[model samples]
Target: MLGQAKAFSSFSTNDIQQTKAFYEKLGLNVKVEDMMGEMLIMQLNGGGTVLIYPKPNHEPASFTVLNFPVQDVEKAVDELTAKGIKFEQYKDLNTDEKGISHQDDFAVAWFKDPAGNILSVVKDK
Candidate 1:
């Protein structure tokens, strides 16, 4: 019954301004809204919105909160790296020097936002 409802993902940040700058640097369309308080609305390229709200005691999520699927994981990683983004290396996950892990039919690279929230870029083979 709720399938038709337009749902969006939301996450908490300690500082909205810093979060906004980080997302903007990543080339996301972001806008500030004065709702319950100042919040950020990010327009996803694939079509959807993500709500970013501020909380005084915000704690970063250990798991990835968002994932961007790209045609070429290497290109995406290189571009983001050039933009000053650092990829996370996970020895247990068998990630490569570039921090990308090759699974059965896909490769994924992980990084963190300014607020320390994890995000990833994935490519399917």
Candidate 2:
């Protein structure tokens, strides 16, 4: 029944301004809203929206909350690294020097937002 609903994801951040700046640095289209206090609306590339709200006692999520599909994981990693983004290294994933894990048919790299929420760039299928 809800299949036609235009649902969106939401997450919490401690500082809205800092989070907004960080996402802007990544080239995302972000806008600030004053609804129920300060919030962020991020417009994704292909088409989708994510709502970011401020929480005084926010704790970062342990699992990845967002994933961006890129044509080349290596290129995406390089560009983000040049922008001062640091990729995360996982011991069990067999990640390379750039923190990208090469599996049988795809590659993926992970990084955290300014608020410590996990995000990733995965090789597009």
Candidate 3:
């Protein structure tokens, strides 16, 4: 019944200002809406929205909470790195020096937001 419904992802952050800055600096249009409190509405390119609200006991997700599809993982990683974003390195995965893992015919890189939530940039295949 919900198949036709338009769904968007939402997550919690400890600080809305810091979260907004981080996302905005990455070139995403972030709008802070005050709804009883403060809510960050991320207007993603090519059409999509993500809601980010503040929570007191916010815990970073162990898995990737968001994934951005990029044409070139290497280029994306380089741009982010230049913006002072650090990439995560895994133990067993064959991640290169840029912290991108290539396996199963797909390449992906991982990074974290200011609030410590894991986010990723996947190679568009």
TM-score of each: 0.96, 0.97, 0.95
Residue 51, model 2: Cα distance from true site in angstroms:
0.1
Arranged by lDDT, best first: 2, 1, 3
Return the lDDT, model 3, position 73. 91
lDDT per residue (tens digit) for residues 32-80 in model 1: 9999999999999878999999999999999999999899999999999
For lDDT, candidate 1 versus 2, the one ahead is 2
Q: Write the per-residue lDDT of candidate 2 for residues 13-99, one digit (tens) a residue.
A: 999999999999999999999999989999997779999999999999999999999999999999999999999999899999999
Local error of candidate 2 at residue 58 (angstroms) = 0.4
| Winner by TM-score | 2
Q: What C-alpha RMSD separates each model from the true structure? A: 1.0, 0.7, 1.1
Q: Which residue window of length 10 is worst by lDDT in model 3? A: 42-51
Name the better of 1 and 3 by TM-score.
Answer: 1
Residue 120's lDDT in candidate 3: 95
* Model 3 alpha-carbon miss at residue 102, Å: 1.0
Q: How many angstroms is residue 102 displaced in model 2 relative to the true structure, after the best TM-score fit?
A: 0.5
Q: Which candidate is the best by lDDT?
A: 2
**Ranking of candidates on TM-score, top first:** 2, 1, 3
Q: Least accurate stretch of 10 residues (summed lDDT) in model 2?
A: 38-47
